[model samples]
Target: MQRNASKPWLGALSALAMLSATAAAAQDKITIGLLEDVSGDIALMGAPKLNGTLLAVEEINNSGGIMGRQIEIKHLDPQMDNARYQEFARRLIKRDKVDVLIGGITSASREAIRPIVNRSDVFYFYTNQYEGGVCDASMVSTGAVPEQQFSTLIPWMVEKFGKKVYIIAADYNFGQLSAVWTRDILGKLGGEVIGEEFIPLGVSQFGQTIQNIQKAKPDWIMTLNVGAAQDSFFEQAAAAKLDIPMGSSIKIMLGFEHKRFAPPALANMHAVANWFEEVDTPAATDFKKRWRAKFPDEKYINDMGYNAYVTVYMYKMLVEAAQSTAKEDLRKVIATGEACIEAPEGRICIDPKSQHTSHHMRLISVDDKHNVSVTKDFGLIEPYWLGEVGCDLTQHDPKEQYDPNNLPKK
Candidate 1:
């Protein structure tokens, strides 16, 4: 009886050891949570972002995944609501137990989840061009900041258009910071900001703003409206016959939604972007072909989508480099700035201090076909353009450093 009991105990121990080894070997299957907007005003940006992220994951998995285990993505829709975003963040961290988190189409949404992310202990990657000056330890902002978006565009517009400018933006953080940056950069470039107006987000009527624009008669109309507000503003601008050469920051001609909603008068409008499908770059072409083949019905592909897709691949690269799903280890690897994505533009690298990715920003125009085409490519812009100006514009305190509301006034 004693000999039989000893054999059974040894067998149980052997089984447990095998299980432990399997678990150790399977550490490459890094789980990520995608908190994005699929159904809301910003769905145009969010839905495609999710699709892009999935495509990246699919490609990575097909290419043998990370360290032999498949990468898994758990997606959640926040519906563009702050409260919902907070809840989703909690679910992603607590229930889903994701190793990393990515997705935020708007600055408001990013702001909403910032605190939750800081407390969650999971690495968060924000992949949208936004208002600048965010330095957070827990978050990596891979999107173009104010310096990346406004710094180049402002000077370019001043040189191409005229010195006098009118600024119109949604009354939010993004809008405010964009307006401030426009004022500052244009002023430095010898341009004058003649008029600046802030409209509430989703406001349908722009007749009054147009009237103000006409009265000011600035040489160029600089805009920062997005989502429903952009639709309303452009529609009303066309209806009101406000025909000034307009240059905008966010959602000027982002995707099919903007192309469909914006009137013909808004054609040839210029905006700075990280990527456009028409650029004909090797990376862009390959991504477009694969994406089109995969989702034949999909009409438009924008930077928002491309960024999300790249994030997944970036996650894969970091995971593979670390060879484990340990969140802290992956975070350190990504934060090192050594990891890069072969994006459409070229080699995209993260700014080690700010944890923001650097990529090419193009000065693109919407043609008569409602298709966006690039006119001039501003080579890669780093994360902190204002770093020289005494601003610790790194990724240490993203929330404290970036406040769209407290933007500079003309």
Candidate 2:
């Protein structure tokens, strides 16, 4: 009896050793960190974006993952707070030591966390349709930039409608830089900027702004506004019976304001984006199907979601080509890698110099019943504005984001 009992103990010890070894191997798995806003003013955009990232990650993991090892994600909501963004970013870089970091809804939030990730030499992806001009080796932007958006949008709007453009934008880095770009583009179209107003982030009442627009009587309105508070602008514009045609570079698709607010409020509104929920393509159809399967209750998937999805796949491709998760190794692949990734919108190639993707943008209009229709498609446009001002990541390890000031005025 004693001999048999000792034999059982010996077998137990052997099994314990194997379990420990397996756990150690699992610890070496790649970890990706996501800092997003799920319950704040920007949550309208952030929640869908996070859902999109999760969907792509699940797809990649189900497809044998990277190097036969599983990929894990650590997600945290920053509530659209700048301080929380910095704090959470530090924890992800220093404590979690995540291989890649993704998410940043606003330009201010992005700027807050960018330095921390850059210092730690971790790969960071910011997928918001921002005010362009970011150049960093450790950073890759898959979002539509101002030049990419306005170049196609402004000319079309100017041709369809008269040239006096009224502008209303949120007051931040994105809004400020976008205002400059708007001025430049309008000037090129030989149009006049009749009036421009910058509203604070959470200012819901746009009574004064609406009154100003009425006074100015511009031919069309171009809005760079953001957040739920800014969404009220559409309702107010309708109540005031402001019949001016509208064009937007960022708001309509990212915020899904058309879905949130009813028709007539957003009727006859035109916006340009790389992707929309209604894009008729096999890839897009499949993406929507998968998204519905995972989140049956979710209503819409906008460009914000599309950006998140594309960025993750792009990172995966770069990692596979590099065959390593080390920042330096991945940077080399991204800085010089030439590969096309099929996104829901279309095939996109990352510019080795600027780290921005070339996108096929579509001009869309919202009807009185809140239906979106694609009017025109601008296929596969490069970030020529950034390229023109000497954006090159391989030349040196410069970590500064360029301003749109250097871009050509005319």
Candidate 3:
């Protein structure tokens, strides 16, 4: 009887030890939250962004992940609704407790969760080309800023295409700020702005705006619209036969959005972009080869999707460099402006002051074959809005400048 009792005790002890080992192994996994618009207006961009994030995570995990722990991402679709964005952000912070967050294809979605991120003290990496003037200690802007996109593109347009300009943009923070900077820069370059118009978001019919552009007959038309609205505007302009040359801060040719709507009529429209996968560079060629192998059907990867992939790898580098997932330490490392990602556009880095990324911007034009092609390379542009606009970011804390409902009024 004593021998049998002793045997049972030993077996129970061994079971407990095995369970503890399994628990330790599970705890080693690192979690990241990928919040994006996968089901709404910007779904075209969002779907690819999600896929790119997944591809990056897969590559990292396959290589043994960060410090022997696999990286796990929780994908959440906010559906492009502002309220849904806030809710999912709360889930990421409270429920999932993700080590970091990545997403935001649209400026409106990014702005919606900006305050929530600040309040929770989470590191949110936003990947999209947008208007500048955003500096936050907790947030890292990894996309092309106004300096990277507009500053170079606008000046090049003025010189190359003659500078009597007309501006038509979506009526929002991104659009408003883009128009403001365009007007400011054009004036500095001895150019005249003949007309400026703002349209409400999601307004499909652009008949009135097309008429206005035709009547004004500006030397160049600069646009800042996005999503379906941009498609609609271009379609209407083509139908009306308004032939003024158009330039955009957003790269319309980088994705299928323009292909499905604008078609041959969109041929010759110019855009400023950070990267084009087709351009033959060592970095771009390597990326294209790997990407094509992975996705045989996909002909081209859009800029936003490419940025999403880059952001994931950038976060991995930061996590490994810091050797800790503590939000404060990670934030400091990102804000230092020295970190860079191996992107198709070559090495891209963030400017410490503005917290905006600096990368090579390419001027792309739609060709007669209905395919987008790179026309010119502007090379690398540094982030310097304070010098350009005379507004200092160093004087004030980013936290102090952040107001949830009240964005900078134009």
How does residue 78 of candidate 2 score in lDDT?
Answer: 95
Q: RMSD of each candidate?
A: 4.9, 4.6, 5.0
* 2 versus 3: better lDDT goes to: 2
| Better TM-score candidate (1, 2) | 2
Show the lowest summed lDDT stretch of 10 residues, model 2: 401-410
Q: Model 3 segments beyond 4 Å from truth?
A: 1-26, 253-258, 335-337, 386-396, 400-410
lDDT of 3 by residue, 1-410 (tens): 78768699787888999989966765798888888787877787777678778788888999999877899889899988888888999899877777788887777778888888888867889988777666566677777876677777788888888889999888887888788878878888999889999888888888888888888889889977766655677777877788777788775634554566646567657888886555778878887777777777664577887888888888887778778777777656655656677777888876666666778888887764667777788888877663244323344444422222234433
lDDT of 2 by residue, 1-410 (tens): 78768699787888999989977775667788999899988777888889988998899899988777688999989999999999999998888778899998999999999888878878899887888887777788888987779989989999999899999999998888888888988897799899999999899998899999999998889988888988899999999898889999876788778888877899888988998888888988988999889978776787888899888888888888889888788777766657468787778888887888889888999888988899998888887676678767777556666665664232
Clashes of 2: 0
> Model 3's lDDT to the true fold?
0.76
Between candidates 1 and 2, the one scoring higher on lDDT is: 2
TM-score of each: 0.87, 0.92, 0.87
Local distance difference test values of all predictions, in order = 0.76, 0.85, 0.76
| Candidate 2: residue 168 lDDT (0-100) | 94
lDDT for predicted candidate 1 compared with the true structure: 0.76
